[model samples]
Target: MANDKHEEIDPRFKIANREALIGVGLALFNFIWWFAFAYGLGSKPVSEYHYILGMPAWFFYSCVIGSVIMIILVTVIVKFFFKEVPLDDEGEESP
Candidate 1:
């Protein structure tokens, strides 16, 4: 016996998936930025390293500044791109 029944998918899942992808993209970008700066500048010998605000150039840019940039970027992304979806099913009638 084969019974066929199709269930409708919740539209909220699509929105959530899009938001999740955006978050993953941001994380990938953050990792790339950190890796590039950390290795690109830190590859030099300690004697040739430059200091920024009393910290090594690579450490300052890759850790301190990278964190600040990520914070601002996430803030802007959430403020402008993310949608506010209601979590509760408000108007449905119970069976």
Candidate 2:
């Protein structure tokens, strides 16, 4: 019956859904950034080096800028969206 399929979901699953969405988004972003850096910059000629600050532009963008962006994103997402879950129900009584 339709009612059987509509049984109440556990509360932990609600939190899990939100966290999974955020994680998937972050993973997609990482993949896109990785591809862009590898193909967009890595495709250039080896001798044609563009320096940002004594380092190749590709390195600067992929390593420094990309790292900073990822760090900021992770920090913001974890701080704002992630919830702390109990490791174990040590103190809770069993039914």
lDDT by residue for model 1 (1-95), tens: 12121113456667888999999999999999899999999999999999999999999999999999999999999999898989876764433
TM-score of each: 0.84, 0.71
lDDT of each: 0.88, 0.77
Model 2: clashing residue pairs?
none
Clashing pairs in 1: none
Off by over 4 Å in 1: 1-9, 92-95
Query: Per-residue lDDT of 1-95 in model 2, one digit per residue for the tens?
Result: 65343334345556877899998999899778867876688789978878888888777887778888889999999998888877565655543
Candidate 1, residue 30: CA error in Å? 1.0
